[model samples]
Every structure is written in C-alpha cells, then in structure tokens.
Target: MSSSFDKFQKRRLISSYFSVVLSVFLVLFLLGILGFFIINSKKLADDFKEKIAMTVFFKSEANDSILKAFGGELKTAKFAKSYDYVSKEAAAKQHTDIIGEDFLTFLGENPLQNSFDIHLKADFVINDSIEKIEAGLRKNIMISDIVYDKQLVNLVNNNIKKVSMWILITSIFLTIIAVLLINSSLRLSIHSNRFIIKTMQMVGATKSFIRKPFVMRSVKLGMIGAGLAILALIGVLVYLEVNFPDLGILDDKLLIGIVLIVVFGLGILITWLSTYFATQRFLNLRTDDLY
Candidate 1:
C-alpha cells in the first residue's frame, strides 16, 4: 500500500509538471507567431505597393536618344524605384499577343507609342505622391502622356491600411488570451498541491519555505517550455526559408532575436507570478476552505 501510494504521488508530480510546461509552450508559440507577423508587416506592404505601375507614352516625333534620356532622368527621380523602356515595336507586339491579332498589319501602321513602365518606391506610391510624380514626368518634352491606375493605387493603399489595422488588433487580442491561458494553467498546477500546502502548514513550515520548491519547479518548467517554443519557431522559419525562399522573413536576425527574448522573458514572468499568487492563496485558505 505504501509503495503504491508513493508511485501514485510520483506520477501525479510528473503529470502536473508536464501540464504546466505544455500550457506555457502553447502560449509562447502563439505570441512568437504574432511577433513574426508584426515584424514582417512592412515588407508585405512594400511588396503590394510594387504592383502600382505608371506607363509613360512618348510622341512619334521624340527620337530614341531623347526618350532614353528622359528614362535616365526618371531613374534619378526620388519617386522612381525602377523603370523598363519598351520600344514602340515591342509594345505593338505585346498588344498583338494580348489581343491575339496583328492590328499593326491590319491598320498598315504601328499606332503604339514608345513607353516606360515605371515602378515607384513604396514611399512615393501613395495617391498624393503619384500626382507629384505625374507632374514631374509631364515636364519632360519627350513625354506625351503618363498613364496609371489612380483608382487601383487608392484601393491598394486603403486595403493595406485596413488589413494592417485588423492584424494588429488580432495580434493584441491573441496575446492577451495567451497570457490569460498560461496564467490559468500555472495556477491550476499549483492548485493541485493544496493538500501538500496544508500538510506543511500543520508541520509549522514557513510560507516562503513551503513555496520555494514549487516556485523553482515552475521556473524550471517555464525555461524548458520557452526553449521548446523557440526551437519550434526556428523549425518553422527554416521550413519557410527552404520552401518559400522569396518570403525573406527569415533574413531579419534582429527581429528573430527580439521574438525569442519576448517569448523567453514572458514565459518566465507569467509562470513565476502565477505560481506565487496561487501558492499564496492556498497558504491562506482555512482547512475547511481548502476542502
């Protein structure tokens, strides 16, 4: 009977410790993911902004050198990220490919204009900045007209703002939920020791003396849980690097280090506080209240 009781107690100890660690691990993993998204939000916005292109068409009277010079000037512009010059012939061919017909031959002339497809940097891709860029482009005598999707640019900006705001709200909500869950789990783990706490009280043990072992155990569990979470997060980043190399999220070492620090620090803090409070409650409970 004595041996059976001892084995049961040992099993319960292991089970309680496992439960604490698993709960902390889950919460830490969630916060780590939130941190990753928050850090990469700028990169994502820039990527979407690159889709807004401006095509500047030139008049037939403009010579090749003049048009090329205008393009070179655009390269020096503050708004321009890059530009691709398309000859009239190439534009005509591209149009033909799209329409699936030789419209140039049918009309006995290539009506297409030499154009530059300009991609603006993220800073200058805003709607107001686009007007400034357009005004600057129009000042060039070699340019006939600048064409861009004003509505598309506006839509992209508005949508990106909405999405970013929503993501930030969601991350904050999930972080709160994760903290609560970890706190509750740690409290419950300490709650399981109510009887032991009462027994220690009957033996005239000091509160701190009784609580020290539990607090140290909780801290150890927290460290283990945080280490596991960091390892799991790293595994995910490695997978992304191998399979989705273009994402580039894994390249930011500073952001990765920040995430690891937050997870490790949070795990220890939450576990320590929860353990201390829960043990204090048990220590103060009357014998009948504990029952």
Candidate 2:
C-alpha cells in the first residue's frame, strides 16, 4: 500500500506538470501567430505600393542616347525601386495587341512616344513624396510629362495606415490575454503543490531555498513549452509557404527570428515570475489554509 501510494503521487505530479506545459504551449503558439502577422504586414503593404507605376513620357527630340543616360541616373535614384524603358515601337505593338487591331496602319505612323514605367519604392509612394519626385523628374529637359493616379496613392496610404493601427491594437490586446492565461496556468500548478510547500516550510527550509526549486522547475517547463511552440509555428509557416508561394511572409527571416525569440523570452519570464509569486503565496499561508 505504501509503494502504491508513492507511485500514485508521482503520477499525479507528472500529470500536473504536463498540464502546465501544455497550457503554456497553446498560449504562446497563438501569440506567435499574431507576432508573425504584425511583422509581415508592412512588407505586404510595400509590395502593393510598389505595383503602382508612374509613367514618364519622353519628348520626340529625346533620342535613345539621352534616355539611356536618364535611365542610368534613375538606377541610382533614392525613390526608384525599378524602371523599365518602353520604345515607341514596343509601345505601339502593345497598344495594337490590346485593341486587337493594327491602329498604326490606319494612322500611317506610330503616334506613341518613348516612355519609362517607373516603380517607386514603398516609402516614396505617398502623395507628398511622389509630388517631390515628380517635380524633380520634370526638371529634366528630355522628359515630356509624368503621370500617376494621385487619388489611388492617397487611398492606398490611407487604408494601409488604418489597417496597421488596428493590427497594433489587436496585437497588444492579445498579448495581455496570453500573459494572463500563462500566469493562471502557473498559479494552478503551484496551488496543487501547496501542501508539499507548507510541509517544506514546517521542516525549517528557508523561503529562498524552498522557492529556488519551484522557480527552476517552472523555468525549465517554460523553455520546453516555448520550444514546442516555435516548432509548431515553423511547421505552419512552411506549410503555408509551400501551398501559397506568393504570400511571401517567410521571406523576412530576421522578423521570424525575432518572433521566435520573443515567444521564448515571454515564456521563461512569465513562468519564472508567476512561479516565484505563487510559491511565495503558499509559503506565507497558515497550516490550516492547506485545506
């Protein structure tokens, strides 16, 4: 009967620890998902902004040599992400293909002029920055006109700003929830061991001496839970990327690394603090309170 009782108590202890670790893993996994979205949101917005191209038409007098020099200059421009030169003939051909007819035959000559489709970097896509860039581009004598949808630029920026603000707020809210849930789990685990803690205190163990083991054990559980969460998060990302290659969320390796570190850090920090306080609570309780 004595051996059986000892085995039962050991099993109960293992069950309690498993539950605590599982709880931590679930909470941290959800937090990791939010962190990933927050980190990649800006990159997604940038990709959308980069697709809004600005067309720069050149004057008839502007020869290929002048355009080539301008192209070289644009390559080094701070605002420009990329630029593609379209010859008058190429433009005419594209137009004809779009209309499904040879308009050049009827016009008797190609009316289209040389142009460059400039894709600006995300940071320079706003109206004010674009206006400055346009003013600078117009100063070039070879350039005839610059055209882009100003309203569309404004819309994109406005919508992205609203979305980013909401995401930040949501992330903060979810983080608080995760902290509470993890803390509650640790408290419950410590509560189950209250009798043992009181027994240690009665046997003349110092508070620090008694607290050290619980703190260390909780920290180890936290690390294990975090490691499992990280693995699960990575598996989800890999599966998503494999199926939807264009999402590009996994492209920013640095952000992913930061998210993993944050999950692990939060796990260890929250558990250690929670365990310390929880053990301290039991340590201060009266013998009768063990009931």
Candidate 3:
C-alpha cells in the first residue's frame, strides 16, 4: 500500500507539471501571434506609404540635356526609393491602352507631358517631409509641376496611426493578462508543494538550497514551454507561407527572428519570475498556513 501511494503521488506530480507547461505554452503562443501581427501591420503600412508616388511633369520645351540632369538628380536623391521616367510618347501609349482608343489621332499630337514617377521611401511619406520634398523639387527650372494625392497620403497616415494605437493598447492588455494567468498557475503548483517546503525548512535546509531545485525545475519547464511555443509559431508561419505566398511570411527574416526572440524571452523571463515569487510565498509561510 505504501509503494502504491508513492507511485500515485509521483503520477500526480507529473500531471501537475504537465498542466503548468501546457498553460504556459498556450499563453506564449497567443502572445507570439500578436507580435507577428504587429510586425506585419507595420510592413503593410510602409508598403502603402511607398506606393504614393509623386509625378514630376516636365515643361513642354524641356530638352534632352535638362531631362538627363534631372534624371541624374533623382537617381541621387536621398528621399527617392525609385523613379521611372515616362516620355510623352510612352505616356500617350499608356493612355491609349487605358482608353481603348488613340487620342493622338483626334488631337494631332501627344498631349501628355514627360514626367518622372518618383516613389518616395517609406520614412519620407509623411506630410511635412513630402511638403519639404515638393518645395525643393519645384525649384528646378525644367520641372513644370509635381503632383500626388495628398488626400490619399493623409488617409493612409491617419488610418495607420489609429490602427497602431489600438493594437498597442490591446497588446498591453493581453500581456498583463498573460502574466497574471502564468503567475496564477505557478502559485497553485507551488501551493501544492507547500508542505514539502516547510518540511525542508524544519530539517535545517538553507533557503537557497530549497529554492535552487524548485527554481531550476521551473526554469526547465519554462524552456520546454517556450520551445513548444516557438515551434508552433514556426509551423503557423510555414502553413501561411505555403498556402498564401503573397502574404510574404517567409520573406522578412529579421522581423521573424525578432518575434521568435520575444516569444522565447518572455516565456523564460515570466516563468522564472513567477516561479520565484510563487515559491518564495510558500517558503515564508508558517506551517499552520499550509493547511
């Protein structure tokens, strides 16, 4: 009967450990998902910003020398990501394709101006930056006009700010909840072993000695949980990459690395701290409080 009881206790302890690990895995997985979403949202915002190109039209009499000089300046511009020159002929051809008719036949000449469609870097797409850029570009003698949808730029910027704010708020709230839940699980697990701690203390075991094993065990469990969470995150990313290639899950290695580090770091750090506090609570309690 004594041997059977000991075996039963061992199984129960194993079950408790498993439960803690499982709880931590779930929390960390959700946190990883949120982190991935936040990173991708930023990428999407930049993509939108970069797509708002500024079309710089040239004067009707602008010659090849002026065009070449302007093109060279655009190539070396600090704010420009890329630029594509569209001659009047090419522009008219594009217009013809769009309208499904040759406008040049009726007009007797190509009316489109030679222009350079300049795609700005993501960081320079803001209102102030764009205004400054336009001001500087307008000073060119051969440039006729610079045009882009200022309204579209404002819309994208405003919507991004709003979405980012809400995402930040939600992330903070969920992180707090995750910590509390993980801490609660650790406390309960520690609580179950309160008598063992008290007994070790009564036997003249040093506090450090008592803590070392529990802390190490908890750290190991935390590592296991974190590893599992990371694997799950990777699996999800793989599935997304395979099924929806356009989302570009596998393209940004740096962002994915950061997310993985965060998930693993949070798992280890939170679990260690929660376990330390949870174990300390039991270690400080009176024997009578163990009941």
Candidate 4:
C-alpha cells in the first residue's frame, strides 16, 4: 500500500507539471497574437503616412525649366521620397475629368498652374514637419502655394498616436497578467514537492543546490511550453496567409522572428523566477506542513 501510494503521488506530480506547461503555453500564445496585430498596424500606418502628397503649384510666370529645377532639387532633399510633375495641360485634363467639362475653354486659357505632387518620407508626414517644409518652400519666388489635406494629416496622426498608446497600455497589462498566471501555475506544481524541499534542507543541502534542480526543471518546462506556443503562432500565421493572402501581415520576417524570441524569453524568465520564489517558500516551511 505504501509503495502504491508513492507511485500514485509520482503520477500526480507528472500530471501537475504538464498542466503548468500547458497553462504557460496558452498565456504566451495570447501574447504572440497581440504582437502580430501591433506589428501589422504599425506597418500599415507607415504606408498610409508615406502616401500623403503635397502639391506644390508654381507661379504662372515661372517657366517649365523653373518647375523642373524644383523637382530635381526635391530629389536631393532627405524629407522628399518621390514626386510626380503635372503639366498645366495634365492638371486641366484631370480637373476636366472630375468636373465633366472643359474648364480651360470657359476661362479662355489654361489658368491651372504647373505643379508637382511631392510625397514626403514616412517620418516627415507629421503636421510639424510639413509646416517646416512649407515655410522653407515659401522662400522660393516661383512657388505659388502648397496644397495638401491638412485635416487628413491631423486625423491620421492623432488616430495613430491614440492607437499606439492603447496598444502599449494593453501590452503592459497583459504582460503582468501573464506573469501572475504563469507564476500561480508554477507554484502549484512546486507545492507538490514541498516535502522534498524540506527533506533536502534537513539533509544539509544548500538552498542553491536544492533550488538548482527545480530551476533547471522549470527552464526545461518553459522551453517546451514556449516552443509549443510558437508553433501555434506559426500555424495561425500560415492559416491566415493561406486563406487571406491579401493581408500580407506575415511578410515581415524580421518582426516575426523578434516576436518569437520574445515569447521564448518571457516563458523562460517568468518560469525561472516563479520556480525560484516558489521553492523558497517551501524551504521555509516546517516538515509537518508538507502533509
């Protein structure tokens, strides 16, 4: 009966350890999903910002050569990404296409100024940066006015900032929750070994010596859990890519690699810390308390 009881206890311990690993896997899996959404959202935001263009209209007195020179100069500027020059005729045609009539004929001549639409680099798409660029451009006599959707710029930047802040707050909150949950699971698993800890202590085992084995076990569990979670994350990513190829979120190899590394690191760190503390608690307990 005593031998059977010991065998049963060993089986229960193995079961409890597996449960802890599964719990950790679930927690890390959730974090991985959140990371995927965050990375894609940032990529989309940069693409949106990079597409915003400022139309620099030239003065009528400014010849084609002058407008052409401005375009060439913009290419050398760090802030400018790319540009398209629209001749007066092309601008008039565009306006006519929109209005469904020949506006130049009504005005008796082509009143539309030759302009170039300049796309700013992603980092320079903010209101403050555009204001500075506009001020510098104003120094040129041949330039008439710069036109862009100021309200759109304001809306996009403001929304991006809010979304970023929320993501950051959410990430932090989830991380704390992850630690608590993983720690709790690990504590329960360690609780089964409380008697073992006390026995080691009574036998003159140094705390470090007793703690080392448990910590190593925790590390092994964490690596296995993290690996399973990463596999699940990869599976989800593959499913999404296969079913909805247009999303293109999984295209960023470097970001995906970083996220996986983070998941793996978090799993190991949280488990190790929890195991170390949990073992310490049992070490302080009386041998009778193991019952």
Candidate 5:
C-alpha cells in the first residue's frame, strides 16, 4: 500500500508540473500575438501617413521661372520629404496611357497643367498640417490651385486615431482577463493539494515556509513560458520579414527589446501574484473547508 501511495504521489507531482508548464505556454502564446500587433502598430500608422500627399497645380500660362521658384521654395520646406515635377506633356501621356487612346487628340492641345506632387514627412501628414500647407500654397502666384482629397485625408486621420485607441483599450481588457483566468487556474491547482497544506500547517510550518517551494516553482514556470513566447514572436517576425520585405523597415530593435522586457515582466508578475494569492487562500481556509 505504501509503495502504491508513493507511486501515485509521484504521478500527481509530475502532472502538476506539466500543468504549470502548459499554462505558461498558453499565456505566452496569447501574449506573443498581442506583442506583434503592438510592435507593428506604429509602422502601420506611418505607412498611412506617407500616402497623404499634396498636389500643386500651376496656372495654364504660368512662366517656367515662376514654376521653378515655387518648386524651389517647396523643396526647402521642413515638412516636405520630396516633390515630383509633373509636366503638362507627362500628365497628358499618363492620361492617354490609362485610357489607351489619344484623348489629347480630341482636345487638339494638352489641357493638363504642370503640377508638383508633394510628399510630406509622416509627422506633418496630419489634417491640420495639410490644410495649413494648402493655405500656404494658395498664396503663391504660380499656383493656380492646390488639389487634395481633404475628406479622404480627414477620414484616414480619424481612423488612425480610432484604431490606436481601440488597440490600447483592447490590450488592457485582454490583459485583465488573462490575469483573472490564470489566477483562477492557480487557485484550482492549489485547491487539489489542500490536504498537504493542512498537514504542513499541523506540523508547525510557517506560511512563508509553505509558500516558498510553490512560489519558486511558479517563477521558474513563468520564465520558461516567457522564453517560449519570445521565440514564437521572433519566428512570426522573421516570417513577415521574409515574405513582406516592406515590413522589414519596421523592425525596430529598441521596440522589440521593450516588448520582450514587458512580456517577461508580465509573465513573472502574473505567476507570482497568482501563486501568492492561492497560497494565502489555502492558509486561511478552515480544516472543514478542506474536506
């Protein structure tokens, strides 16, 4: 009977250890997905920002010197990333190429005016800055009109703001849910060993002494989980970089390091917190409650 009991106890111990390991793996997997999004969020926002450009249309009869001056001034602007000078002939050719016919032949002359396609820095791609730049361009004598899809720009800006807020809120909500779920799981795991805890108490074991081994085990499990999560995250990032080279620009080392730190810290914190609370509850429970 003693040998059978010993074998059963050993099995239970191994099962509990594996259970902790599995839980850690699950937690890390969830965190890895979250971290990938959070890390790439800024890159996504910058891509949207870069797509917002300003078009400066010239007067039909504008002198070449006047157009050159306007382009030169815009080139010196702090917010301007680059500018493309689109000649009337080039614009007409573009239109013809798209239509696959000579629309210019019907007009007998190129009706398209020479323009500058202005690309702005991501920081200055906000709606207000674009509006301000448009207003500034209007004061130039060479400019016949400044054309941009104001509504589209506004929509993009608003959507970015909304998405950022949603990401933050969702991350927080999910983290809280994760903590609660892990805590409950730990409590249940500890509850299974209530008799062992009671027997320790009867033998004059202090609460700290009783909690040390469990806490140590929890910490070790947490570290292993965090390491697994980091590896999974790196694998996903590697896959993205290989398949989508454009995303490689967003592989910021600093941001990735920060994410790893946060993941490890979160794992340790959650594990410690759950273990502490579980042990506390066990210590406070009545002998009758154990039954």
Candidate 6:
C-alpha cells in the first residue's frame, strides 16, 4: 500500500511539472511575438520618414552663384539629410520626357524652374516641424517657392502615431491577459499537489521548507520553456530573413542577444512569482480545503 501511494505521488508531481512547463512555454511564445513587433516598428517608421521629400523651387532668374550659396546653406542645416539641385534644363528635359518632344518645342523658353529636392531627418517630418522648415527656407532670397505634400506628410505622421498607440495598448492588454492565464494554469498545477502540501505540514514542515522544492521545480520548468520558445523564435527569424531579404536589417546580433536575455529574465521572474504565490496559497489552506 505504501509503495503504491508513493508511485501515485510521483506521477502527480510529474504531471504538475509538465502543466507548469506548458503554461510557461505559452507565455514565452506570446512575449516573443510582442518583442518582434516592438523591435521592427521603429525601423519601418524610419524607412517611411526617409521617403518624405520637401522641394525648394528656385527663382527663374536666380543666378548660379546665389543658387550654389543657398544649396551650401541647406547642406549645413540640422534637419537636412541631403539635397539634390535640379537645374532648369534638367527639369525641362524631365517634363519633356513625360509630355513628349513637341511640348517643349511649342514653348519659346523652358518654363520649368530650378529646384532643390530636399530630404529631411526622420524626426523633422512632423507637421509643425515641417512648417518651421518651410518658413526658414522662404527667408532664402534664391527660393521662389517651397512645395511639399502637406497632406501626405500629415497623413503619414498621424497614421504612424495612431498605429504606435494601438500597438502599445494592445500589447498591454495582451500582457495582462497572458499573465492571468499563466497564473491560473500555475494555480491548477499547485492545487494538484495539495495533498502533499498538507502531508508535509502535518509532519512539521515549515512553509519555506515545503516551498523550496516546488519553487526549484518551477524554475527548472521555466528555464526549459524559455529555451524552447527562444529556439522557436530564432527559427521564425531565420525564415523571415531568408524569405524577405529587405527585413534582414532586423537580424542584428546585439538586438537578438537582448531579446534572448529578456526572454530568459521574464521566464525566471514569472516562474518565481507564480510559484511563490501558489505556495503561499497552499500553505494557508485549511485541512478541510485540501480535498
């Protein structure tokens, strides 16, 4: 009878350990997905920012010397990424290419103005900042007009802001839900060991003495789960990199190391927290509640 009881207890312990491991694995998986988005969003936003161009059209009668000085000044500006000076002839040729040969022949002279194609830094693409940049450019005597898609820039900025906020809110909500789910799963796992806890308590085991083994088991389970989740994440990253070379920028070694460290740290923290609380609950349970 004693031998059978010990065997049954061993089976129950194994089952509880597996349950905890499975729950930790799921939590880590969710965390990995969240981390991927948070890591990539900034890069995507930067790429979009780089594409936003501000055109500075020069006066038709602006001399080469004045235009060169203006271009030099623009290069020195803090927000200017780079600038391309388009001469009147070049602009006319581009327009002729679009409209056909006879269009420019009908005109006595080139109607197209010289212009500077300006690329601004990512942070400077915001509406208010662009307004300031436009005002500053208007002060330049050589510039006749500053043209940029105000609506497009504003739309991109607003959409990015909205998406970022949505991601933040969604991540927070999902994290809370995941924690609760993991905690409940751990509670169930602990409840399965209620009889053992009661038996230990009856045998004069202190709360800490009874908690130590369970906590250690939880730590081991969490580590295993975290390792499995990390392997899966690595696989997904490799697949993405292979399939979409454009996303290869996300394969930075330092960033990958940081993600792995976060996953391991989260595993340890969640395991410790859940196990500690579950053990406390078991320790405070009455004999009648053990069943």
| Strongest candidate by lDDT | 2
> Which candidate do you rate higher for lDDT, 3 or 5?
3
Clashing pairs in 6: none
Q: Which sequence of candidate numbers ranks them by lDDT, best first?
A: 2, 4, 3, 1, 6, 5
Q: Please provide, for model 2 over 91-119, each residue's C-alpha lDDT reduced to its tens digit, 9 standing for 90 to 100.
A: 99999899999998889999888999999
Best-matching candidate per TM-score: 1
TM-score of 2: 0.83
Cα lDDT tens digits for candidate 4, 84-202: 99999999899999999997776899888888899998889898999999999999998999899999999999999999999999999999999999999999989877878888899
The weakest ten consecutive residues by lDDT in model 1 span: 67-76
Tens-digit lDDT track of model 6 for 1-291: 999999998998787777777777887887887888788888778778868889888887799898889888887899898889999888888877887774667788778889999989988999889999899889878778998888988888889989999999988997787677667777887888788998999999999999998888778888988888888888888888888888664567788778878987878788888889998998998999877
CA RMSD of each candidate after superposition: 1.6, 3.1, 3.6, 4.3, 2.4, 3.8
lDDT of 1 by residue, 166-215 (tens): 98899889878877887788787888789999999899999999999988
Provide the clashing-pair count of each candidate structure.
Answer: 0, 0, 0, 0, 0, 0
lDDT of 6 at 278: 95
What lDDT would each prediction earn against the true structure? 0.88, 0.92, 0.90, 0.91, 0.82, 0.84
Whole-structure CA lDDT of model 3: 0.90
Q: Using Cα atoms with residue i matched to residue i, what is each candidate's TM-score against the true structure? A: 0.94, 0.83, 0.79, 0.74, 0.89, 0.80
Tens digits of per-residue lDDT for model 3, 187-233: 78888788999999999998888988887887788889989999999
What are the runs in model 2 whose C-alpha is more than 4 Å off?
A: 1-11, 99-109, 236-258
Query: What TM-score does candidate 6 get on C-alpha atoms?
Result: 0.80
User: After best superposition, candidate 5 residue 51: deviation in angstroms?
Assistant: 0.4
Distance from true position, residue 117, model 1, in Å?
0.9
72, model 2: CA deviation in Å?
A: 2.9
* TM-score sort, best first: 1, 5, 2, 6, 3, 4
Better of 2 and 3 by lDDT: 2
- Candidate 3: stretches off by over 4 Å: 1-11, 33-44, 105-108, 199-206, 233-262, 286-288
Following a full C-alpha superposition, what root-mean-square deviation does model 6 have from the true structure?
A: 3.8
Clashing pairs in 1: none
